[model samples]
Target: MKTVVAVYTGQGLADPLKKVFQELLPDVRLVNIIDDSLIGDVVKAGRIPPGVARRLVQYYRNGEELGADVILNTCSSVGEVADDAGKLIGIPIVKIDQAMAARAAASYERIAVLATLPSTLEPTMRLIEKEAAAAGRAVTLVNGLAAGAFEALNGGRPEEHDRLILETAERVAGEADAIVLAQGSMARMESKLAAATGKPVLSSPRLGVEQVREVLERLSREGEAAR
Candidate 1:
């Protein structure tokens, strides 16, 4: 059996993605390694500082050590590290937001990045910008911060968190060609955000899992070919 390990900085992300994996990647065993401090540390430092970056790489390495066929990094804030660590990990490393960013950049000219955390917003926007350039599209990005949504989600009031996200999303929608939810924790509100915004709402969970599946399948094909 192939084992897929997800390294997450927040349980809000890890738990929901776990559920998605259960439904979508049933045959593959899913494991989680979490470091809650990573998110808070990044937020405080306003960037992935050296220590945190080292830890991020180490976390992925540990996943590979545990016999991970694929490593999924579920936090958008530090998702960029996967771009750097993919080869070092010696397995497919799925950055949760890469597919979403590519889709957003290609689908919309005005991309609205909605996040509850400042740290997440910056990296997600940077990811979108890079994708936009790659696609040869000149894009404008608008940042939307849903105040208190993260707190509500963490405090065990997901409904309230969803409500806050919807309200802010409604306001951000008119200005955006499509809306991108910056954090994996906000993945659950895709439908609500779409209905509330009447535009394409992008979240990482679904697309991220699909990418994980794609990488694993591709590796399986190559292995078969080699044999």
Candidate 2:
């Protein structure tokens, strides 16, 4: 069976992707490479060291050796690194939120981004701004960061965490046409947040999975033709 590699900095991102993959790509095998130790405080602080990019490249190389048809990095903090890895390898490499960012810019002129970690919000905003410029659209980006939301999610109070997320998301409701959940983990509350705001909820993991599946399906088709 063909396989794809999905690298994550923490289990929070991987757990959701597993659910997504189960629903979307059950036939395709997935190799999960999770490194929780690297998470540390960098995610909340919103910083990525230069070395992180190199580490991502190494991960991609290993995935290539394992014959992965594609590689996906689930952390938005290392998005640029993920792109860099794509350039280093001929095979497909995907940044988790790229497609979500592009879609968010297209669907909504005013967008609210909800993130648990401060570091994720700014980079995500920059990504949305870049995508909006590429699409020739101007978008208003709003931030909805709830204090301790990340802790709540990781601390095993998902319902409470989602309540806070929905509350914050609702505050930006009238201000934006849609909401973008910056991290895949934040995707857990996407539907609830959308319900609270009565606007479309865009999540990185779902969109990213869809986009990567498109690429991989294309690759599969091309390979079949070549055979």
Candidate 3:
């Protein structure tokens, strides 16, 4: 079985992402490494601190040592770190939001990225911009922050969190060709936001898992060719 190591900075997306893996790559072995405090440290620093980045790199190396065929980074806030780590890591490192961002950038001229935290929102936006530049596509990005929603969710009021996200999506839908949820945790809102706004809503988990499947397939083919 192909082994995948998922590194998470928070617990919010763990179950959802695992479900995706179960559905999409059931034969693959899934291993998780979660450090919930990493998110707090990033938020406090307003960016990924050097120490935090080093720790994340260590986690990637640990995954490699565990014989991971691929490493999945599940935090948009530290996505750039994942990019850098990819250069040093032997196996593929997939940032959870990368495929979603690439799709949004390639398909939409006006994309709105919604997130509860500035830390996630900024990195997600930058990722889309980077993808767009690589594709030679000029895209306009709109930032939508569901202010207080993260706090509400952490406070055990999920309904309020959903409502706030919906409100933010509604407000930005008028100007955006598509909506992208900046965090994997917000994936549950994808279909609802698309239905409510009549727009394409992109989320990370499924797309990221699909990308992982693609990588595994490619690796399999290469292994066969070498034989």
Candidates' lDDT values, in order?
0.89, 0.82, 0.95
Off by over 4 Å in 2: 154-160, 224-227
lDDT of 2: 0.82
List residue ranges in candidate 1 displaced over 4 A: 152-160
| Alpha-carbon shift of residue 138 in model 3 (angstroms) | 0.4
Best by TM-score: 3
Q: Which is the better candidate, 2 or 3, if ranked by lDDT?
A: 3
TM-score to true structure, per model: 0.94, 0.91, 0.98
Instruction: Estimate candidate 1's alpha-carbon lDDT, on a 0 to 1 scale.
Output: 0.89
Error of 2 at 146 (Å): 2.0
TM-score: the better of candidates 1 and 2: 1
lDDT of 2 by residue, 7-104 (tens): 88787777778888889888888998877755554664458766666676888888888889888889887786776666689688888899999998
Put down candidate 3 lDDT per residue, 168-217, tens digits, no spaces.
99999999999999999999888999999999999999999999999999
Ranking by lDDT: 3, 1, 2
Give the best candidate by lDDT. Answer: 3
lDDT of 3 at 215: 94
Relative to the true structure, candidate 2 has a C-alpha RMSD (angstroms) of 1.9
